[model samples]
Target: MISVYIGMGSNLDGPVAQLEQAILTLTNHTELHNIAVSPIYSSKPVGPQDQPDYANAVMRLDTKLSAIALLDLLQSVEQEQRRVRDRHWGPRTLDLDILLYGDELIDTPRLSVPHPYMLERGFVIQPLNDLSPELMLANGRRVQEHLSQLDTSDLVIIKEV
Candidate 1:
């Protein structure tokens, strides 16, 4: 099984409930195992501050599915949760993204592994650090080291769960 990480968030009703349900959904999948979850963090919306802040967390899973397949699974989960993608970075009921897949770097029309924005987004990096502090990036640096190099002042951990 390949070790993979997923970032999950929701700003709508019962955000924590949505996250918990999503985690259960992924674990129920026959292809995923060894599931692990990070403590949930409440964060301010990244793009449009007008919307409600979000509850976010990272999940680690050992999966037998390929990258594209895993992406498909996440999309299905979003759809099942009624996530609307009417606008870019808009508010949603659920959002999931591929953060990392083993040490493989991929760039394809359909998908990209080691999510392109992983390093740039504090929301993603912070929760990831909580889940795996010493986790190494494909480039050979630890996640906490990368997080230290970032400015997460705008991203507040309003609560922990």
Candidate 2:
């Protein structure tokens, strides 16, 4: 099995409930195992200020599926949760991204492991730190160390998982 870290977010249609449902879906899926989650955080919108704040968290799981297959699974969960990609970083019922696929580096037209923006996003790193404080990204930075320098002043613990 390969270990993977995934980021989850929602800002529309009851953000917390959306995340909860998606988590349930993932944990119940046959391909994923040894699942773990972090406390949820509420943060301001990353791209636009007009939308409501987002509910976000990070999840770690072991899976036998390939990285692309896992990405397909996440996208399916998002769609099931009514995720509408009407605008870029606009608003959605759910958004899931693969933050890391084990320690392997990957970049493809369909997906990218070690998600490009994860290091800079406090919402991502904070919960990620909670789940795996000793976790290191492909770039060699520990989750805790990277989180220490972020301005997570806006990230509030909305729920503990």
Best by lDDT: 2
- Scored by lDDT, model 2 comes in at 0.92
Model 2 lDDT tens row, 1-161: 99999999999999999999999999999999999999899999999789999999999999999998898899999888888889889999999999999888898888877899999999999999999999877777789999999999999999887
Estimate the TM-score for candidate 2: 0.98
Task: Report lDDT (CA) for all predictions.
Answer: 0.88, 0.92
Task: Count clashes in each candidate, considering only residues at least 3 apart in sequence or on different chains.
Answer: 0, 0
- Residue 23 deviation, candidate 2, in Å? 0.6
lDDT of 1 by residue, 3-47 (tens): 999999999978888898999898898899998888788788878
